[model samples]
Target chain A: MSVIIFADQFQGKVKKSALEAVQYGAQIAQQLGVPAVAVAVGEIDGAELSALGQYGATKVLHVADARLNEPEAGAVTKIVAEAVAKENGAVIVFAHNFAGRSIAPQLSARLKAGFVAGAIGLPDTSAGFVVKKNVFSGKAFANVSITTGKKIVSVMPNTFSLNPGGGSASVEAFAAGLGDADFKIKTVKVETVSGEVPLTEAEIVVSGGRGLKGPEHWGIVEDLAHALGAATACSRPVADSGWRPHHEHVGQTGFTVRPNLYIAIGISGAIQHLAGVNGSKTIVVINKDAEAPFFKAADYGIVGDAFEVVPKLTEAVKKYKGN
Target chain B: MKILVCISKTPDTTAKIAFTDNNTKFSEAGVQFIINPYDEWYALVRALELKEAQGATVHLITVGGADTEAVIRKALALGGDEAFRVNSDSQDSFFIASQIAEIAKQEQYDIIFTGKETIDYNGSSVGGMVAELLGLPFVSIASKLDVNGGTATLKREIEGGEEVVEVSLPLVLSAQKGMAEARIPNMRGIMAARTKPLKVVEPAAAETLTSIVSFELPPAKAGVKMIPADQVEELARLLHEEAKVI
Candidate 1:
């Protein structure tokens, strides 16, 4: 029995989450006294696939299928299930990403295994294989125990740090049993949101709210984000008011993110918005109003007019970057 | 077309989280349970749109006990044609997926929809498991969806940009925002929902993969710090020297 990890790929590039998933899967396998095997679907080059050794993948099962490039969860479920059966994986680990969240459960059902999503840490195998996860929209955490033979878990992104220095491993090509019907989900068109890093995956995030006055002022925020190499976000009201795209909204009703540093400008911290960003390692709130709730949760707060403060902040960031 | 939208009754976004029974069960003593907002946008609203366009029946399903009936009824009022309850609190995703799978097997739904993830448990698993169990297709976190001629068009987000996908009928999609705006039920819809049919079915007993041992609230924020409004530039200096975030 081995631990199988679905290392997600995008246009042949391995995502950071996939590397973290492998690192985690390797740890779990060590705890369970089993070998860790990884599989990558979609466009993956053999040479790049062999480099999975850095994350403790003993073997990489590369499935170069065009159908896997799209975001159809069912097709991935079948492919992952096939790999698990071939490798006799007692446990399967997937990054709790948009794709993993949808596909892990399906694979678990096909394997009749127990499943857990949003795992935060490694299992405590002192007793049963138990995993901890954030629940209640990241307001609370729950520890879970799995008593079944086969277990599936979707590890939360950025929860575990990726480990390097596992050295290069061997790669193998595999032909999993699948058909056109298995590729049931078809792609018609993918609407692209241009020139912004995905908030969920960004190491740093720069967000603004109505306090910025209008969409015209967005340039300053964007400039600061550019210098910081950070993603951009807006408050729900900002999105609702058409000041920013809905994809940039960060709140309970919007995108949840956990970055290494989250800088909020001219935004009051509402509980809903906090639910989405409370996971950030450090929070800095820059707002004119001292009564703003976001200040309480912030690791640092600057009470000032954003129009004045943001420009200065942008200059400082640019200076720091020596750009 | 027959569509099944699964929902979970969760605490409203503003509710103060607390636990009871030695920090075991979530305290419902004061918290208000609202329809997960993602479901309201992705599942319920989208279902209503489909119902309007295709003249199809939409059913609401949940895997909770009788207490969740009101929430289920609320879905009916919003737009669902009927409701079903699996009559068990399957906390584990594997167990809940099985219950949903069993229901899908019996109902044979053409399309299954759910929120990208619930606000409470945040387990984005059921729809995918149901799709797999039924041997149907699954697409998740779809921000855009269109149905035509037994095929579906969807726009899903990834780490960098978004990916557009197409799939045949008999599939599942976990909806995110931007799919559709959530609609509130009108008086007529509310009145009609009162008389709508609600079916309660027992769940198939199965061994669970995971069991919750305890629950803990996130550590609370200490308090707000104050800085003068004019010292905005100083804040920038502190961000680098103090926070070391820059």
Candidate 2:
């Protein structure tokens, strides 16, 4: 039996989170005295497939199917289950992102496996297969033990580091049954968020809240994000008000993120909003109110008007990068 | 059209989460509970909109004990026609999905709806598992959904974009934000909800594959360091030299 990981890709390039998943699965395979294999669907470069060995994958399975360019969760689930069965996989690993979330549980049910989603750490195999996961919107943690014969883990993004080593993974072609019935969900349109790093994979995130006042005053936030090479996020209220698109919202009721540096400007840091970002390694809060609740949770605080502070910070970041 | 919405009772978002019995159980001393926000704000509200627009009947279901009836009643006040309490104290997602699938199979509902994930457990496992068990298509994290005749149109959030997809009827959808606005129960709706039917059914026998061994709270943050408002450059230098994040 082996540890099987789903190395997700977009536009033929392997995603960073998927590399993390591969490394995590490789570690699990080491613990189980087995090999780690990665399965990927859609168009991927031959060099990229061989590079999987750098992440400890012994072999890579590719299904170069154009039908899966925009994968339906059901079809992907079938394909992954097939790969798992083919490998006699004891543990299935996935990066707990959009694709993982859409497909993991269905595969778990199909395989009668116990699935642990949003797992923050590797499983403890000493006693049993116990995994730690975030609960209550990161307010609390739970240690879950999987008693099933088959196990599935969807690791939270950014929780595990990608470990690269030297080797070449052998690639093999697999038949992913991409029947026309699986494409029952017809895609009418795709609205892409162009020219910006995805919030989930960004190392730094600069977020704005209602304190930014209105959509017209968003230039400073954009400028700061661009200067720092960080993704832009907004509190739920800002998204609800249409100051930013809904996809930009990061909070308990929205997207949860765990970047290395999270800068919140004009955000009062409601508990709900903090729920989404408290996982950040370093949190910086910028608000006019010295008594804002966000200051309590922030690693650093600047009590000033964002209009005055953000532009100055952006300039300083630009200057620092120049040197 | 008949729509089945799955609602779970969760502690208020502001409620302090605590564990008891050696971290093996969630403490429930005086915590106030409500319908999970994602279910209330998106799934239930959207179902209510469909009910009003197309004369659809919206039914709510919860996999919990009698204590959750109050939260189920609140969902009815927000315009659900009826509710079912699958009497079970188990918190396993598979067991809950099995119960929900059994109900869906018997009822022959055209659509199954639920929140993207429950905030309490934060496990987005149920809806997909239920759809798999019932052999139906599942649309996840849908921000917008509309049904016309036999086809359902969905706008779901993907990694870096929104995907517009269409599927036939009898599908399952996990609703997220932008699906519908949160609805407040008016006095009339609340009074009408008092008389709504809430049926309690025994759950089907299903085994749980996983169990929570213990719980722990996240470590508290160190007190904040106050940087002078005028010294923005210093903050940038610290970010680069100390934090090494930027």
Candidate 3:
């Protein structure tokens, strides 16, 4: 038996989350004493496929299908299932992103495997396959034990650090006989967010909220984000007021972000808002009100006017960067 | 067209989280339960809109015990034509999906709608598993959806941006924030909801493959290190030297 990792890519470029999944799968394989094999579908670079070895993949199964570029869940499931059968895979791993969220459950249903999504840590095989995951929107944690012969897990992105080592994987072509039936969902158009780091993949995030007052004052948030080379996010109220797009909203009803550093500016931390961001490695809150509730959850706090403190913080960051 | 919208009940966002029975069960005392916001605000509202726009029948379904009827009545008040409560309290995603899929297969719904994920478990698994069981195409995390004749178009968030996709009828979709606006039940709707049919059906045989061993709250934060406004630059120094994140 082997461990199979689905290495997801976007437009032929492998995502950093995919490498994190590879490392996670390799560790699981080590615990089980099995080889870890990563399966890459769609149009990806050969060099990128070989680099999977650095993240602990012993071999790479490349399904060079152009149609997979816009992954339809059904088609990708068929391909991943074929790879699993070929490798005699006992465990399947996916990065719990868009692709994994869309495909992993279908795969579990198809294979009748016990599946876990948004897993935050490694499985404890000593007592069956128990994995920990955030529940109640990160307010609590649940240790779930999968009691199936075959198991599937989707690791939350940024949960595991990527450690590249010295190695090269042997790439082999695998044929997945997919047809028109599997391509039921057709992509009509793609509009990608340009020139900005996506919040889910961002290591550092600078977020704003209602305390910023209006959309016109958003430059301070952007300035700090730019200085930190981080992505910009907002609380739900700011998005609801049209100060920012709904996609940039980070809260219980919006995106859940687990960045290395999260700076909440001009925001009072409501329970809903904290649910989405409490998983960040470090939290810094800046608010004029000392009892804003966000300060309680913050690692660092500066009670000051956003109008004055944010620009100064931006300047401080810029000065620290020597620009 | 007939649409089946899946509903789930979750604790209110502000409710204090606690566990009982050796951390295996959520403590419901003093907690107010509401229809999961994603379901009430997005999936069910969108289905109700489709019912008005295209003369479609919107049906609600939930996999829970008899106590969930109150939550189902609330959904019915929001304009669902009818609702079914599967008589099972299984929290297992696969088993829950199986029960729903069984009903959908017998009823032959042209559209299956669900929230992207329930706020309580945040699994995001049921919709896709239901679609797989019934051999239907599944589109997830759809922010926007429009239908024309037998074809449906949807907009969903990708890693960086959004993509527009098209699929034929008899499919499944999981709705997110941009799908629709939340609607509050009017007094008339509340009165009408009392007379609406809420059928409780027996659950199909399905195995629960996973079980929760325990639950734990996140560690409490060490008190915030308050810094003076003038020493804002020290925040940067601490982030760089102490936190080492920069």
- The candidate scoring highest on TM-score is 3
* lDDT (Cα, tens digit) per residue for candidate 1, span B33-112: 88888887678899889889978889888889888888888899998998889889877766777787787787888788
**What are the fnat scores of the candidates, in the order listed?**
0.79, 0.79, 0.85
Candidate 3 - chain A - TM: 0.98
Pairs that collide in candidate 1 are A185-B166, A185-B167, A186-B165, A186-B166, A186-B167, A187-B165, A187-B166, A188-B165, A189-B164, A190-B164
Sort every candidate by TM-score, greatest first: 3, 2, 1
The lDDT for every candidate, in the order shown, is 0.82, 0.91, 0.92
Prediction 3 TM-score vs. true? 0.99
Q: What TM-score did chain B of candidate 1 earn?
A: 0.95
Better of 2 and 3 by lDDT: 3
Best by lDDT: 3
TM-score of chain B of each: 0.95, 0.98, 0.99
lDDT of 1 by residue, A1-323 (tens): 89999888766778788888999998888877887899888887887787888888889887888777764576677778888888898889998887788788888777777777889888887988888888887888888777788888888887776669847768888887778766666666555565666777788899999999899989988988998889999999999888887788887878778888899998898899998889888888988788898888987788777878778777767766678
For model 1 the local lDDT of residue A162 reads 64
Interface RMSD of structure candidate 3 (Å) = 0.8
Candidate 3, residue A296: CA error in Å? 0.3
Candidate 1 vs candidate 2: the lDDT winner is: 2
